[model samples]
Target: MRDNYREELDDIRGCLVDMANSVGSQLSKATTALLDADVTLADLVIAADDQLDATRESIEQRCFTLLARQAPVATELRTVITAMRIASDFERMGDLAEHVAKVARMRFPDSAVPQEVRPVFLEAGHVAESLVTKAGTVIAKQDVEAALELEEDDDAMDRLHRQLFREVLSEDWPHGVETAIDITLLGRYYERFADHAVSVARRVVYLVTGEHRINAAG
Candidate 1:
């Protein structure tokens, strides 16, 4: 019976890793849809978010089931709790990607990003993708070193986010109110996406260390 309980805990960890991979894909595909101005692809990305939501719900339910039946203690309890938290982060990450795709769909047929600032969003997308991918690996391996490295990796996304604000607030800005608003929201979406990835990494760190704290950098 204890062996079975341990197996369930391992499966929950696996589910978190799988959810992270799906979220990473959503971020990448949303970025492509945004850059390409392809509403069709954007629509596909939007539709696929349902799967992310469903997967997270399943993970959360498993957490509850483990708590009720297995009564995990100490590190094992931390494992279940952190799995729920990480699942929430993954769900939020998916929502952020959907928001980006919705932005792309909103400005369909023409790029939502202005030419001058396109590179910023592109780089932001890449950084988000990189961070979440790293977060997934950290969860799967529970590597404290790589988990800690997520904080440093998030710096790239933060820099790009600041650059975006500078562009939006510049005296020479010429994209008009609509584009500026879109840029502002996109900047936020990407920033939050990176934060969610960092959150998952931090949880993994806690699972390993029993620290149970959010990262300071975030």
Candidate 2:
């Protein structure tokens, strides 16, 4: 029975990694759709979110069953708990990406985004996609060092988000108020997406070091 439990635990870890990859793909596509103003791609991102949602649910169910059956202790306990937490974070990341895709689909033909602000949005999208991809790597490899680097990359997205807002507000008379609002929300979505990826990376650091590096980072 112990052997069976051990196998199940490994399976759970694999499932979590799979879930992370799924979320990463969704985020990448969603951001791409938004940047390219590809409504069809945006629609695909929205549709694909359902699969991510299902994957997370399956992972959570297995985690729960393992806890109930094995009553895991020590490292096993830590593994199960971390898997649950990680899956939840990945699910939220998927939701945020879907939200960005929605923005693309809704604002197409005349994207609410101003021509001048396009560069900022593009930069934010690129950084956000990179962060999510790196996050998947850290989760799969348990590379605490790589996870630490992701925290710094997150700063670029934050800076771009702030600049976008500043530009929007500074304009004495903005064109297409609706488009401005959509772009503002879209920028914020990307910022928050990176923030969640950082959260996942922080969890990886803790899982590897048993120390919460989030607060320790100065």
- Please report the candidate that would top lDDT against the real structure: 1
lDDT of 1: 0.88
Best by TM-score: 1
Which portions of model 2 miss their true places by more than 4 Å?
216-218
Please list the C-alpha lDDT of all candidates, in the order they appear: 0.88, 0.81
Across 1-218, the per-residue lDDT of candidate 1 in tens digits comes to 89999888888888888888899899899999999998998999899999999998999998999999888888888888989999999999999999999999999889999888889988888888889888989988988888877787788889998999898899999889999999998999998899888888887888788785556555
For residue 15, model 1's alpha carbon misses the true position, in angstroms, by 1.4
lDDT of 2 at 17: 74
Question: Over 4 Å off in model 1, which ranges?
Answer: 212-214
Q: TM-score for each prediction?
A: 0.96, 0.91
Tens digit of lDDT per residue, candidate 2, span 118-161?
Answer: 89877877787788778878877889989988978888887898
